[model samples]
Target: MNIQTTLKLCSVAALAVALSACVRVSTDSGDNAAAQADAAAETLQDAAAGAEPADAFLARLARHCGQAFEGRIIANEPRSPEPHAFEGKTLVMHVRGCDDPTRELRVPFHVGDNHSRTWILTRTDSGLRLKHDHRLEDGSDDPTTMYGGDTATAGTAQRQEFPVDQASIDTFNARDGLSVSVTNVWAMEIDPGQRFLYELSRPQDDLNPQGRLFQVEFDLTRPVDLPPTPWGY
Candidate 1:
């Protein structure tokens, strides 16, 4: 080839190599950025995965942890005979154990002098769960224990509702012959420095004239001294 043409060809080859090198550098930079972004996203997810939607509500309840409050039943009727036993007694609920990630809270309810019941709230993958843990004074499990329900929605931060689950229904039916309890719904509400309420209701039907709803409210503004240890640890 001619000298001029050969020199021109050499210049073209050098330019091509330089362009290829630039392209490789640009690709590597993009890949590194993408990797950094992915790592950041994964770290955020790890922090959030340990939290539940009902975390705010759980925190509110936890605020009262290690404290006790007096309560009184405001609604009666359509309730199991068990509630009547709490009447004419000093009703107290002591917010006991609290573990956020596992989402478990143990609040022992003291009726008059009987410390046989505990209200347990737990966090599930879907939402939340509430269970009534009853025990004898000697700490033996009650035959009709662990009957409660799971949350049906992403309830507000101040409140959450739990519609009776099948397990609760079966327990009620087997223990008390209350097959109708399958339609029961329970809810808990907390307003910091105001009041905390626990409620139960059933769907309206021929048996229930207007559907049975029972609620008990505690004075949150006042935290009384802690009571004796609950029946079960």
Candidate 2:
């Protein structure tokens, strides 16, 4: 072959090789990006599928951490023989103690000037647990403290019901005039940016045929000023 022809052929061959390399690199990069996207999608789907209802409920409640809400007694039924402490009282709930929100949340339930009650929600291996930590003015535990229960089922993200556990039942049995609370079923509901509900119910029984129901609803749309720290922390 002539030198000029050989040189021209060599140039053409180099150009073709360069074009091939560029096409291959572009295709490889696109394939890698697609693979990465698919992996991320799968990971999200898996996480969603594995998530439990209690997890979603906790997450929803955690959104209100560091805030406070005003509540009112919506229903106090059956009319207790004695006067109710919540009647004509200003109710406030402070959501705090959320350093490890995924595991625990402490919400102080203030009635008028009383800061003796706290609702503690904790995550468990099986589901979630709710405990009423009652304290005296001097930061001492009350005789009827820690009287709540764990969730019995996989409730919705907006609500969870806790049936009185054996420990609470025993506590009730040990106290006078508290036997009526042995069959209590407490439920908490949250509608983000709308409202929250705390409910207590008892089925009809021989001791009290009328049963019982008490519910307090909080307005989440307007966060109130942070209340005092709960007694006994």
Candidate 3:
């Protein structure tokens, strides 16, 4: 090759090397920035988990969203017809519709052939709130619906307690005439990738001095197939 041609080739090779180096530097900067940003986010989440118990609990439950688990009544007291209704029937709870931005979650509880109950959890300014949304098979709201409560204490990441609030008591007495439920206290426990438990009890009083207790537990180790659309969505 001629001298000029060799000089041209060398210039082109130098330019190519410079360009490659520039590209590598750019890529390394971007990757480093992304990794640093991810680390910052994780740190913030960890701090939040330590500061807020409700947020931590909700985060754990959100992990199970879009999954359904089978459950059975583990404990019951003050024998009644309601317990019999769940006997010999498939019980399922489907965690669905997690809106983290809005801090709301909807979990549908299906008892055998009934798909009328959906448990709604919302992150209120004060604390966490639980409301029962019951609907008819045709998707109409039940008159005796929306009877749950807010968290009274800072529960653990795996467990939350909800004692019936005055609003729930008023609603129950007015709508269903069930004045005895004014002292109801409900609880939910979650063992991520293991189990979930729901419990209800009433404090001792003149109306319900014996104190009612009902509990149902779900196996979360294995997720079942999605069931039919819950009534009223």
Candidate 4:
């Protein structure tokens, strides 16, 4: 009977030890599973953040969005006035479309109170491009206009602008009467004291029936004192 009792006690101890080992294994498995779930959730969140193409482009555009800048127009082809000048013209850019950005964002400009224009910029594999998306008063692409000209002749190292394509021309006109092209870009610079500057030349032949040559200097710096609205009211 003593031998039997000793054997029985040993058996009971073994079973208890085995049960504890199983419990430990189960707890470890639960912890690992929880950790894996958390990792997967984080991965999913990262994907969601990058899914929107517009958001990415908007983030890029916002970097240069809110700053006030003066626009200078250069006419490659001159028509009337010997040369047209936009030196004294005033314009404003209101960038409020970031709420829901797209691959392209259209922001409106108000000349104090005159509905000036809507500039649309799009993201492309090459770089950021102006949509040149415009509509005619009749909502059509004017058959007589060209969106942009070829920039390949400028220089290989200078990728400031791309060659204009025929496809882009009809797309903007048919969808909207407005389309624009960057003819030439020169002297792009920015100052740490909140100033940005660039020179742009546009072919006025597209807009006016008679060719026009024009260029204007841009003040990219923020406005300190915009003149009061034209004294009409």
The sequence of per-residue lDDT tens digits that candidate 2 reaches over residues 1-233 is 99999999999999999999878767755645554454455446436777677887777778789999999988988988898989888999988878998899889999999999999999999899999999999999998999999998988777899999999999999999999899999999986666789999999998669998999999887788898888887
The C-alpha lDDT values of all candidates are 0.81, 0.88, 0.83, 0.43
Could you give candidate 4's per-residue lDDT for residues 1-233 as a string of tens digits? 69999999999999999999878767755645554454455446435675343333344335445444444444334444554433345555444345445555554443444442444555555444543333444445434332433232322111224344566556545664445432233322222223333234444455544433333333433443333222111
The total of clashing pairs for model 3 equals 0
Error of 4 at 188 (Å): 7.8
- Count of backbone collisions in candidate 1: 0
RMSD of candidate 3 to the truth, in angstroms, is: 13.9
Score every model by TM-score.
0.72, 0.78, 0.76, 0.39
Off by over 4 Å in 4: 1-61, 64-67, 71-87, 100-116, 135-159, 168-217, 224-233
Highest-scoring model, TM-score? 2
Rank order (by TM-score, best first): 2, 3, 1, 4
Best by lDDT: 2
Q: Report the lDDT tens digits of candidate 3 across residue range 1-233.
A: 99999999999999999999878767755645554454456446747657577876787678789899999998888787664677888999999877662499899999988999999999988779999999999999988888999998888766889999888888877854588888988999976666799999987789887778989999887799887888887
Model 2: how far is 69 from its true place, Å? 0.4
The CA lDDT at 232 in model 2 is 87
- Candidate 3, pairs of clashing residues: none
